[model samples]
Target: MTYALVRPARLDLNSYARATGLHPEAVRRLVALGLLEPVRDARGELCFSPAQVAVAARIQRLHHGLSINYAAIGLVIDLLDRIEELEADLRRLSERH
Candidate 1:
């Protein structure tokens, strides 16, 4: 058996903000809210994965298009987390056969 290690490209805060059209503060807020987990590079500065950058773009779109506030987004995220927890419980119960 062979194992493959994959590394995602790391993006700095400013570049990511420019690339995604999101304010760096907004991304920082998400980080503060536990929505994003930026990685620390060799230089000890915070950076984000490409996938996280992609999600930031999506979140920016949702906010810009729908004018959603952080509170609303937080609520939706909470509901989604509950739904995921319920689904996991359902799967566990079904596995009791």
Candidate 2:
């Protein structure tokens, strides 16, 4: 059988902003706030994964839906992430029993 190599999608800052419908400056602000994590290329430019688009959308929802401030959004996102991790761990533990 022949194996196929698959590469994950990566988008630069501007593309990421366009995909998320946010301005590039806003994307940079998110990065500065640690709301989005991006990898740097050889040119030291921020590059985002496709998954981050979902994250940016989530951030928007939380901000607009709940009227949360950007600073507080960081805490909210961290808590949500932790809850997901805990749920995953619980599922794993339950599966063993």
Candidate 3:
């Protein structure tokens, strides 16, 4: 099995909230809503992957720019995840051919 060697730098929840300008409650809500996937650190604090910042940013845009509600955001995020998976599958199949 192949593995990705490049592990992204991790950011603590506080830093993530600060960098994204999102309140801690918002971050917690995102995590609780299954929008953000966070890992626990050694100290048992919430930590997020760097990639999650981009996802959060997109969600922020949808929420603020388009005034999208959480339910709609969930749907959009699900659709986007499916699209990414499909695109990756297509790329792999094309490479095989």
Number of the top TM-score candidate: 2
lDDT of each: 0.77, 0.95, 0.89
Clashing residue pairs found in predicted model 1: none
Candidate 1 scores a C-alpha RMSD against the true structure in Å of 4.1
The model with the greatest lDDT is 2
- Which pairs of residues have clashing backbones in candidate 3? none
- Specify the poorest-scoring 10-residue window by lDDT in model 1: 54-63
Q: Mark the 10 consecutive residues where model 3 has the least summed lDDT.
A: 70-79
**Tens digit of per-residue lDDT, candidate 1, span 19-75:** 777788977888887667798789887798778876776566666788987557667
Order of candidate numbers by lDDT, starting with the best: 2, 3, 1
lDDT, candidate 2, 9-95, per-residue tens = 799999999999999999999999999999998899999999999999999999999999998999999999999999999999999
Off by over 4 Å in 2: 1-8, 94-97
Q: lDDT at 21 for candidate 2?
A: 99
| CA RMSD of each candidate after superposition | 4.1, 3.3, 4.3
| TM-score attained by model 1 | 0.62
